[model samples]
Target: MPNPSTPEFAVVCRFQGLFPKDIGGYEKHRTRNGGDLGHVDPTRSHLNRPVIGKADWAARTIALIEDMKAENFADEIETLTRRRRKKQIKERMAEGPRDPWRATRHGPMREVILTANRDWFDALPTAAAREARAQAFEDAARDWLLENFGGDVVHARADLDEQAFHIHAVIVPKVQVELNGTKRWMLQPSKHELIKDYEAAQDSVGAHFAPLGLKRGERRAEAVRKARQAGEEPPAYRQHVRTADWRKAEDTRIVETRAELDRRTEAVTAEEVALEQKQEAVTGREKAIGAREDAAMAKEKEAGAVLAVGQGLAAGALDIEDRDGTPALIETPEAKSGLLSKLRARMARSSSGRARALHVFSKALARLREKARDEAKTAVARDTAEIQSADETIVEIASRLPYAERRSIGKIRVSLSARIMALTGRDTSRKTPAKGEDDESP
Candidate 1:
């Protein structure tokens, strides 16, 4: 059988700073837990300490760290410190080959590793910072691997050991490394030589740190600006650069939205106030209408009372129609009693005509009716005689009434004059002097 082709891999290195031993609790904690967890807490006593160079040997090397396996695993130090081995070797061992040609490590055993200085570790903010630093290291490490190792590289896992944050990556080689016209062994690189080559590659790409710290949106905008500057189509990395223009646009949008919200709020407030005022106005109008209706009802009641009082006096005149639509005769019981009492008085006073009280009353009413007719004629004559004086007064007073009321009064006055003429058996045409006769020069 031919020697198996070597698995392509990248290596990473990391470091952490240490304080002097006289620090009391710090040293003890460091010794107890190993330095994987940095010295952020003093009371906790044990900050995790990391082990060195466990990238390849992490499965077995975990037991050799400062704490027991359970405590170390409890803190997830293995996950944090282990480098990604792109392929699972144990899984390969599990599946017994059905066909001898198909069983080869060349297919999937990709792996990579990374290393960094203690300054980088201290530069991290907190646990979150540590995570970000790890990710950055992976990304940088992968890029280096692809550029130098000539295969697509992806980080599979990470582990922290002693001072270094290390990663394991998988590589799917596009073109195999040619060693004097033969495939080189993938997993056979000398450990010392691998570290040296990895360091040299990492030093070549140092500018990505600040950009990595930026927010994703900022990174994208920076990429756009760079693309514009270069006068070329934006590269895929443009999506990673954060720039100021995007943030400025976002701020402008926020400010505009706030202003619009304030303006709408003001408009809504104004509308509410206006609606309240309208409601108040409607309430006032309703109250005024109610008052007018109340006054009209009161007037009707007073008129009814007055009609009860004077109705008897005008009873004999019942046969007559007044200017208003009401009859002169008393229509109510109170008015009837009054008319009968007056009739009795007239009968008591007249000796010979005692029994003819009704006739007397009839005669009196007839005379009074005639006199009223004459008086009405004279009143009309007087008004006609002084037409110039009355005209303005009538017009002004009539104008004060509504048009319908004014028309009603005119109709009543005309009907009354016509009725009086018919009762007196007089010709209406000749009863009154002509209009200009009162003003004649004769």
Candidate 2:
């Protein structure tokens, strides 16, 4: 027997295909209730009630059904009827059931309602607190569907104005799956699969809410099985058979658990705030380091440019002319002296002697130019070596910084991921990278 006071987590699923005549009745039940025009105080009726205005019924309802369109699930069936004879059969099937008033071949949709015991919300002191709790439960439940059903949930609404706060989620059972190496869509899920999925979701919801002092309640089927295993007589009303003494004991345990949970929640909230502050400080420091690195790189580039200009000037092939402010060639002292001697010898000889002197002067100038080029190449190589050595020293100094500084980068990434998981209640391990993300390792 389970205590009534302890919150019970329950998930109920039902498949529905509305017939022509049933459509009006179903719509009336969901939107309005009681007599034809609907009751003003419909909440008083235990059977049907007015839905909470805050519930996102339109959005939730849309989520449940939009995926079950014919285009998505009709491929497999359509492929089988590609031949002429089979095409005829497909046309007949498209005509639908002989009874026009009934549902189509795949039916309309399925409804899943996830709920917690009334005591869960009743225990909350404020309406705001209760609403937050309800919203959290609904979000968890929606995530459960997305995980197991591959995003089949189309519509979902939470009704707070009813007897209990519960979520009504509509789901299209269709899913794309790989079978025998072939990918195809399935329209219906097996009963075994649905039951197993529900059980898993039940466990998930229990774990998610445990930190808030909501424990998992025993199910009647599970209780009966345990009783049979122990060779004990099962109670007549297995679902509602908690004794006074058991209830009292469970209530005491819950109170103690709630107190502990509150303390832990407060501690965790404080820790989260501190972690966020640390993360921000780390980010600021990283940005400052990046700026310093950029400045250093800019200085290195400037030094390289200056070295190139100096090498060009030293080569004597480049000279800054004051008149035009442009580079002009400059002759070495030896070359200038040799040219003057050739000019003097040209006047003391025949035309052939003058030609010979002119050739000698040109040879001297060529040799001087070649010598200047060699000196420029040597200087460039030396400067490059020195620059490489400086780079290595800088890298070594960076690596030798305190271990805490190096570890801060990794810690920031880990903490950011943890915070995201805490807020969303999502498993970080299962998250898929967005499109265009590289799959290669760093």
Candidate 3:
């Protein structure tokens, strides 16, 4: 009873499930004239009466049930429904534990109980006055039940012999539900729950008697909601129970749960702090990387600006790769400074006589290609360091040549177009010197 609590004087309306088989015994208990009623005081047992029903509880219940069955044609529908369920159970057996109707049974009809605490009645001046006030409470509760549950409410009776005046009712709700496109009637108590959700059901009985100044008791739901919103550990729910042992056990459980909640909240706080610090560290690293990228781009811009100003890069493509030892058609669009500086140093190193001899060697390379044009490839192992050195010298001379001749000039020749073919040993890269542009004699 953590929710829908009734104050000591307020109305307490509650419903319980009553299965079809248990109806007979319950009807006997409600309609009994004077046999041993468990919680009833033997001296006041005669005080119980059918305050709201047309007859005794059992007789009224039987009449209403008959009327409902005849009006809704329940027998034929129940027969067909059973046959279909049986067929389905048989057909789905191959699916093992997945049969839909395997454990399915009928839900119980509704048995509602409404009452107030005995202290309110005791505080009254006279027994007659208590009876009148109890009558008022009973009338209001009966009216509320009839209004909500309609003709489905079978019987209502008053028990004055109990600790407090209370009303007992049985409502067998005949609900219309559609299954597989066909609509039919069934006794289902849960339909009332759909009509009024849990919280509203709890509020209804108390609100009906609000003019009497009686109030609903406190519950834990609202407090739990606020706690979650504030990011705090919620308080454990404490159920209202009568037995001392049950209440003590629930209290113990709540205490243990509160301790567990506090521990979990502290751990979550620590994790959030660690996560925040990690995110800050990652942000710092990203900023450092961005700064380095910005610096590299700025350096490239400064060097390219100087090259554009000093060299005639805007006028022609400057051959940058040939000035380095690597023979390539690549130009220095941004690194023209490196190419200009390196070429000046290397050309200054070559003597005048040496430059002339290197120029003659370049002419000799062209003649070699012409001579080997028709010669068949021979298996020759060569060590051509002098040829490679001569190739470098020719590149220095080509720096002074025009752009087309510069591209066509160097990567000077070896002896013949004999590719390196080592059949026994490990083979190296083919170093066959290519034919020059002027020696295309084929």
TM-score of each: 0.22, 0.36, 0.43
Residue-wise C-alpha lDDT for candidate 3, range 1-442, written one tens digit per residue: 2235533456566656565555677766665543335566768768887745566556655555566545444443454476777665554444332111112243347677877777876667898888888888877877888888878777788888778888888777776666555454556666786233545676776788766556564545677888999999988875433223454677789999998999999899999889989988999998999999977765555444434322433334433233344333234555556665654444344344224433443355446655775242321223344434655566566666776666555432222112212331324355433333233211
Q: Relative to the true structure, how large is the alpha-carbon lDDT of every model? A: 0.44, 0.51, 0.59
How many clashes does each candidate structure show, in the order listed? Answer: 48, 6, 0
**Cα lDDT for residue 241, candidate 2:** 19
RMSD of each: 28.5, 46.8, 28.9
Best candidate, lDDT-wise?
Answer: 3
Off by over 4 Å in 2: 1-27, 33-109, 176-186, 191-194, 227-442
lDDT string for model 1 (50-126, tens) is 32222333332222221332342322333333433224333433542222112333222233434555555556569
Off by over 4 Å in 1: 1-251, 312-442
Ranked candidates (lDDT, high to low): 3, 2, 1
User: In model 1, what lDDT does residue 407 have?
Assistant: 63
